[model samples]
Target: MPIMFGRTIKRPPWRQCKVGSRDDLQVGQALNNKVMELQEQDFNFTIDTAFTKEIRVERLPKGFKMPTIEQYGGTIDPEAHLESFKFVMLFRGASRRHHVPSIPLYLEGLAKSTEWFECLKPRSVSSFVQLGRAFIANFMSSRVDRKIMANLLAIRQRSNETLRAFLTRLNSEALKVWDLDPIVKFQALRSGIRDVELKKSMIMDEPADMHNLFSRCEKHINLVEVLAAKQEKEREPEKKN
Candidate 1:
């Protein structure tokens, strides 16, 4: 028995073989046979004590359940999938080491079979950030049409859409356009309004900035809600009669 890392490793049977007075050729043959036998046997052992002490493994809390992430295939928007994956990982309090390795488990279809092979290479992807970038690059064409300034400028409040809903839609579109200019945003805000009074008010006295613009919009939004409620209350009596 050999003591290793405070554990006993049983010596292989080859170590106990004795060499009698055999000829030189016979001795070499016997030695070669023993070497081959040693190579064929399995030696199961733990890591060195020093290495085991240096690294700490994190465990999930007892009875904790992992949320199921939607599987990403190459056909869908890669950025959206990546964002959702990141959100779930953050919620779970996953570590950086867990990030890169764990993302592969959620991938399937073309994403797992093809894009994954192209994106991850031993030397190429070391971290989750790098993997995300590579993944997006590989599936960039699958993403929906990228929003531009023209798209923002073309936004219009629909006839039935409330001012609050219109503003919410506008804001969502605005977020998709990268490095948006404040002037362009203000112009979009002004152009998208359908209400005659609100449009006239905005044109007569242009907002100083986005803050002022939203403040004006907020007042109108609240006023519209109040007037609508009052009208509904008045109509109730007529309906009852």
Candidate 2:
């Protein structure tokens, strides 16, 4: 206490306080803990808000079962995976909004796809079509041994192969060739036939288009089958004797 103007005045408690006191240290610790708690709360709120905004969930039709699609691991063909994804989504009656956001759920083990999706700016992907194009562009290198026009032309009918089997193989090969010309496909089929009589017929008649060519091939295919059945029937009599 000090005398001021003949009146006794008590010193303030703060002025008498000492540094490194146990109570001071305890108060400091309490303040630090409270600040950390507030920071953690803010962090959690930010994460929840961002997640809610990013993913838009839609209610599916009652009792409609969702189809299971294989997860893409970035090592396989991206285009094929995307096609499969779209097919299942379409089958499930999912709209464009469902497609754009649901892609991340199907992706796994692919940093390029999963991480890339996470880093994308909000609202950058507008539709499924845009998302598909971007996905293919990113993973195009993973596709192996893509077919070319020459692969279609190189297809040949085997010596022992039936006309029907040969035609099926040729058609399958043609489907794999991208942007194939109709005339080229017609000529390739004409040249690849193994049967001498059928090849002669095709060369002599020179079918107008692919449809006409297939019609001519179908006649030969039927004749071959009929002859095969007749030969087998004859062999049955020899076995009996």
Q: Give me the candidate number with maximum lDDT.
A: 1
TM-scores, each model vs. reference: 0.52, 0.54
CA displacement after TM-score superposition, residue 141 of candidate 1 (Å): 2.8
Query: Can you tell me which runs of candidate 2 are displaced by over 4 Å?
Result: 1-65, 111-113, 118-122, 158-165, 179-184, 200-222, 225-241
Model 2 CA lDDT for position 111:
31
Off by over 4 Å in 1: 1-65, 118-120, 154-172, 178-187, 194-196, 200-241
Residue 122 error for model 1, in Å?
A: 2.2
lDDT of 2 by residue, 1-241 (tens): 7799999988665445457887667767887898666544523322112233344445555776667889888888887888788889888888766676677677777533344454344345556776777777777888655687778778888888877998899888887676789988887887788788988987788888888889988988898889989999989989999
How well does model 2 score by local distance difference test? 0.72
Candidate that would win on TM-score: 2
**Clashing residue pairs in candidate 2 (N, C-alpha, C atoms within 3 angstroms):** none
Give per-candidate clash totals. 0, 0
